[model samples]
Target chain A: MIDSRYKEMAEVGLAIRIKGLKKVYRLGQIGGTTLQEELKRRWEIWRGRDDPNTKIGQTARLTGETFMALNGINLEVRQGEALGIIGKNGAGKSTLLKILCQITAPTEGEIDINGRIASMLEVGIGFNGEMTGRENIYLSGAILGMTKAEIDRKMQDIIDFSEVEEFIDTPVKRYSSGMFVKLAFSVSAHLDSEILIMDEVLAVGDMDFQKKCLNKMREAANVQGRTVLYVSHNMNTIRRLCDRCLVLDEGKIIFDGDVDQAIALYMGIEDHLKTEYHFTEESRPYGRFSHKLSIERTVIEGVCDDPRIGQSYNNPSFGYGGYCLPKDSRQLLSNYGTIPEKIIRAVVESNDTRKKYIIDKIMRLVRMAEQAGQNSVVGIYRLSMKSGSDNSRESASLSVLRGLIDRGCTVLIYEPSLGGLCPVEGGVLVAEAEEFKSRAGIIAANRYDPCLEDVKERVFTRDFFMRD
Target chain B: MTRNTYYLDKNVHFKHISAERKWIDLRLGEVWRYRDLILLFTRRSFALTYKQTILGPIWLFLNPFLTSIMYSLVFGRIAGISTDGVPMLLFYLCSNAIWNYSSSCVTSNAHTFTSNSGLFGKVYFPRLTVPLSQVLAFVIRFSIQMSMVLVILIWYWAHGQIHPHIWALLVIPLSLVQLGLMGMGVGIIISSMTTKYRDLSILVGFGMQLWMYGTPVVYPLSQLPDGWIRSLSLLNPVTMPVELFRYAVLGTGTLQPVSLVWSWGFTLLALFLGIIVFNHVEKTFLDTV
Candidate 1:
């Protein structure tokens, strides 16, 4: 009857029909504090105060943002259809399956399902550890919403299928992770649900198990006439299991039609002629907990292998110079207390620095650069901490200035920090930040701040996110 | 599409679970649906306990016997606590077996979230069933242990070392109710709390150890020196079952009928609250845990 309905819909040009699908996760950990917050919010709503922040997307900048993982995705599925979803992680493939399974409630969405849904999200999820393999069978059955009697009927078959008959008496805790995963997977597959939602569950138990899982999926889809939504990182699984595809990038569907085309799109096989680096900070979005910042106009010079003007890392002469910000300066300071200024500067130096711990020893790099023999003036740039507006740094720009001065080359101050506190004792003041770039052969920055965007060729610094 | 093998009777009100009359009927239906799996779990629980042991199931009887002897000597002789004129060894063994059944269930149930987190993360099921099966398995073990106590009691009765009361007939159903209610109630409560703070799981082990002293397992209520100690001993829910058990079996102590009734009321209340909290906690436990 369901199949006939699907066929009828296809005859009238409807494959899958979805309307106004939305999912929202209320952020913040559920704890005692959350309980208090819930009470407060409920009391406010009861009193008709509106809480001021009750509106959707209104509390975006608070402790947690209300993220719309999926936004109004409407689609139709015909009698026989396979769809593949591709995205660079966090594109909401897993979320869609979870919603279908009703494992979690969507903040807003309506799903009309015509069949039972089975999910192979992970193995050993419905298992009882204290119970032996035999006892867990009953527990697992109840977990799958099957009656105890139903479990009794299926007991022999499940044991044989799992190939864990010998170890059935042993508690699951003693089982190796691999054996446990296999048995759990076997149980899930045996469950006779019509609609299957699998989320990267195949990447377990070794190569044999993986192949078996794929075969099982094929059997469920092709032989059983069951509809399946499978999510995986393996492109080959997508190519094999899926008939059509939907590509999701940054939480939005980028392409949806052909599986082959979707795979190609996912792999970045398409051609684009723009020579400039096409990057958007929002493009590489990680989860809410991780920081995502953008840095532009990084320049590295002074080394013999420095790149030609406007060249990328691919160029032969442009030896890729990447630097790490000293991650825990506070901890390092706490460990050593306050060391001499020279020692602190050397310890926190990024790769571009040529400094020795003691003043008696001269660095080979400085000697080499001096031997190159030009009236080379090195420009010193901004030195600051990680983010926000703060500048209590053991400044590396000062190191470059000092190093250049020690080597008998002209040094310049481009920083206002110098003017306010320790004004350049010996170096010339190139008053204009822009003018300093043209005058100096090398511009060394403690951080790749955005202000030096034009003279990117002469800039040498490591600032992955410009805010730092 | 294959012809449907599964069938639901129209007369069966599948959604009406609130009616106590229908509870067993609906549960039976679900039990029939999952019969094969429950058998699997029950068998698994039994077999796994004895899996790798050299003596295997023999340890089940030996565990309670050894514990009983230790408690009897420590509490019966040195402390001079009367076990209601019953053989101290037999009395402690009977009470210890029941307490073990209930306490094990509670401790295991407390760590339900932390221990089964891996499984819960992956699968869909009525999470209660895992703990339920554990309680059942513990019940089975308790049955075996009780048999040992029965054999010792019959021997002592024949030799005239102990007297048996007609109230002892009530012990069977009373023991079942006493153990089950306490286990289910305490188990659910601990399971709910342990999800958020693992401190409860750690505390349960030590708490159970100290709790034995408060119950009449090692000492009779009459052994209390005075008012506060006697009153405090009565407050422990376990005191009722132990005292009732001693009275029914040995017929040597005053059976405070009112206190016993109060204990029953408390046990039921605890069980009721436990179920409610467990149901609520199970819904959103995954998000927090």
Candidate 2:
């Protein structure tokens, strides 16, 4: 069967043939349905009962609402061709990539791909921080489907390309973030596969590194005759990397053909949507203070005495720092380069300023209490960035602690989540709630906890909304 | 244009590999091609198993040693469990080593799709490589522990406390393979189930502990009353290996021929079902995971 199919495909000279590809995802659950639920549904159907989830003429019945991530995507690529897939967020670009990589299956239709495919969807996958850089190189290489002998042959080249030979023996945890990306990209670039699929991996690393990656991709496609499927939000990169481009909008292919025209078509739709909103001075609700700053001030006013006293003022604790915000903000800043912008730069620096402001307020309160002849020990309520979470990475409380220490203030931390040990030096970790209350002259909290209601008079916080 | 025309003129044969909606596409050939990846994952997990610890690989032996000591104290001294005249240490150690290998394989494979979702999300290597590597890692650890068992068996043999059957050489390897398949099969099924309903993943820990009791790991199969209880224990696939391992090494065990055949049959069926579920889940697990 495969031989006959291959013979038919060979006549067409197509490197990849995808027909009527569709991927429908159930909103909440995995694997579509459970055995019990499926049996129940089947029983109901057998009894001639109407099933709410079934549509007429559709063979598959969904238990819940479903989103068609890729709807009838039909496309083909010739051998050694460079194809770019562009879409807005949720336009099914990632779903398409996942299908091509076979990481996830398409709910319907079929994709026939010729040649070995090496996908770098998110770089630095399978990197262990405890392992040395050299070991991680081999590990990541193998994960990308390179054999041990293949990695051995390219080890020197990978090390040289990443420029981490001096520190290759050091644990990856010790390598700088940039060096880590360099090593990861190097390993993937060295994969000798016939088809390469890359998705926004170049969005990381420095400009020079990105240029090098683009050049390597060019060499892989143009010089060595390899098919390339590139996905990126950057139109410039898309144009540079691909000869033909596909524009996807809401799971459907809107346009497919010349790279420039596809990009133009995408941009045209985006521009049309964007033109509806005008950010002129006349549109500013709060005169000169930009809408962002005004909103920040208003939120601060609701929570604190003044906007200058809290971290973000807008959100009580620092600005958003969950998985996406910090990295995306940095990426946005990098795209702006040296452009003289106030709000953009302030968004990055506001967290630090807020941390400093918190420190200043705590110090002032401590000094006032000391002058009034009270023991000026400041108690830190929690170390986590948000309530009911143990993750302290980029937590505003840590920054506050650092600021308090740098200014030489006596501080005690009360965090049950951190267990018995105090993470910071010079600050005792109070295990008991009563002991913490008695020792603290003033308490600092990112968000208000009801456990401190009895000591509310001594507590200092800017949590108005009381939400994460 | 010239390249396209030349390819058409040459009638170059192309391989069209399409994704199908079949319930049981084993894709065993694809798994075989990615054997190197499986090996690397095995090595990576082995290295990481004790990366940060000061004792390192020594802990591999220490684990079974400590477990056996605890069992000897509890079951031998306190509970007065019979070892059938074979040394209690050797009995527990042998059974524990085999039991640990099988249990670990199932428990670890149960999280195959959930735990490796990060790695699985980005690339395409045969999804089987992950569970296969996990099973291989268990085998490596089992081998290391087996050496310790061998030393104990030899010491007991020297003292004339036990007489191991010469057939042990064949039984040992055969039972290990049986245990590995049983574990892998159960694990893959659980792992596939866990992708959608996480209740199974949570239940696996308690379920494994209960499963250990159901198997004749601590007690000899002969000790059970010859009725429903014995018949039930005989039906358990794990009971065959425990009994077989004890029969091979200690030369005194209740080996029911019918039960042995049932165990092998169950292993094949479970493994077949596991592959089908795993293949079906691997295709679209990301949607839920």
Candidate 3:
């Protein structure tokens, strides 16, 4: 027979237990689009087909579709364990942390938590620009579900740790970005929660502050008997703070155990990637598409072995501009939740402003056609980056396409590769070239081709409009 | 520690998180627990909105003052509309005092989801606290504006242009509550939909303007002679409060028991439906947004 007290002691040591945890999302099916698409997707879902706009490779196991962000993850965290999670971009690391924080609900799963969790997913979770720093301390502390009395108790410690006590009365917006981060860090650091979750937040501030923060986190887990979960690309922090570690790839937990072993695996996985290329023979033309390499360009006369070439994929999995220069730069532009850097946030805002500028141009053209009391449809020439290719479902153009769709614009697709069939379940596919040309008020294409005759399709379409 | 009744229950589970797909999960207890957070949000709203402005709370009073005076001039003088045998300025101000509170409640609560998506995305707390704070935050602005109505009401009462009923004291607060319920209910329902169909945000501004015309803001319910239009006006959740508030303070407006029943019924129904929609949306809105 088992002793009851020992069983109780073991159960008490367990801080969190997750079983078969799953979080599924339809790829690029963010549902703030027009009502027509929303209802159409729902109708398809009701009829037992997958959600129409989801990417092809994602399995549609449930009624809708499944791009499982966290796929059936089972993890047991003991009390006071400092666990480091390392993963490549889009590897479900942040998603798991978000679910643990209960910021978002999982699609399916059971998560049992032993105590309160204080998470610093971003440095300042709720800092109002107009409010002074002293007020923001109360505001942010309250937002973390801390009582006013609790914040009042730790007020001096937080103010001192941030090292900006002189400007504590000034509004946070006036503080420099680094000072803002330090002030925000201090408030979250003093939370006194049973579980502490930090995600790449220590990459900023001067070295002294970073070192101080690292020591605080280590103290929280080791001395304070609080469970800590840290996710970072910086392996050094993991080595210094974590005793256990986890490595996630895609959506599943690929590795878990000793911290050093996880770091080696994470670094080794990146180093093992092979630089190989396969390209079309016609793409080599006088080095016009020089930036895009054709396989035979330069093996450089006995400098290296012949490059892997002339092999086609079994099926199309990627399209034009899949990855851009300074790889992960484009990925960083698209992924918002992971990039917590305040500077990156400004870049994201500028990217949004650029998209907005483009969207305004599209709207202006469509409205000009509508001035005479007629409904005119805007045409999207192709979603694929290259003209002939078909599998750029998640292309850069999709953001602009989605933006137009959001503004209640009627979009007709003219991708010949789709063969005028239903490329998207409810999307209109213009099969007849003459009809496509006649109906479109303005056409928007990502890349300029001889077929377009102008850099912007809307400008080309307008010139065509003037001629007719 | 004594509060932990389950401490000795062998399976002392503290928290459980899963895909909660229930139609109704108000979590009122959780909202109650985070009541301090709600006040803090309200304090931030008070501190932030008034900052960097020369005249702080004065603008709160001035904004409503100008709007009500404009309504009185447009409807009372320009359109030659009657104000139920009371001073046109007094009637409009009285109606506005009640009307603005409820309408502001609806407008503010409608934005609860979209405006706070930043805070909502990163942290965990009862999301209801944000809307409740909005509901509380506007009360400061409302009270300052409501004082303007009070001062004007005294002038009319002293001049013997209006009779002040004892029921003025009782019905005023009751009407405020009813209007708050109706507005918050309708607002949250719209809030839930705004995450997906952003058209609702645009619709809300124009829709509230039209809804004001439906209610007896500019003209009294008594102006529309006894018929289906009057009955429809009675059924409008806002009409009862506007008319009753006028009758209470100025002592000149329509009074019907049936209209009272209809108004309360609609208010309660909107509030009930609002809670269910809001509770469900709080969990699932991030997926769409």
User: Which predicted model would earn the best DockQ?
Assistant: 3
Tens digit of per-residue lDDT, candidate 1, span A229-308: 77765565677788878877654677888887776566542222122221112212223222221222222211222234
lDDT of 3 by residue, B1-289 (tens): 0001112344442566767566656677778878889899888888878788999878887777787789888888899898867988788777776788889999988988999888889998888887778777776667777787789889889999988686576877777778777888899999998888887898899999988888988899879978888878887878888888888888887888888898899889888899888877777678887
TM-score of chain A of 2: 0.56
How accurate locally, in lDDT, is each candidate?
0.55, 0.68, 0.68
**TM-score per model over all chains:** 0.60, 0.71, 0.71
Instruction: Kindly report, for each predicted structure in the order presented, the TM-score of its chain A compared with the true chain A.
Output: 0.51, 0.56, 0.55
lDDT of 2 by residue, A147-202 (tens): 88999999999999888899999999998877888998999999987788998776
The C-alpha RMSD in Å for every predicted model, in order, reads 16.7, 15.0, 16.8
Better of 1 and 3 by lDDT: 3
- Pick by TM-score: which candidate is best? 2
DockQ category of candidate 3: acceptable
For all the predictions, what are the DockQ values?
A: 0.16, 0.29, 0.31
Candidate 2 regions exceeding 4 Å error are A28-63, A273-468, B1-19
Give every prediction's interface RMSD. Answer: 8.5, 5.8, 5.3
TM-score of chain A of 3: 0.55
Q: What is the C-alpha local distance difference test score of candidate 2?
A: 0.68
- The native-contact fractions of the candidates, in order shown, are 0.25, 0.63, 0.73
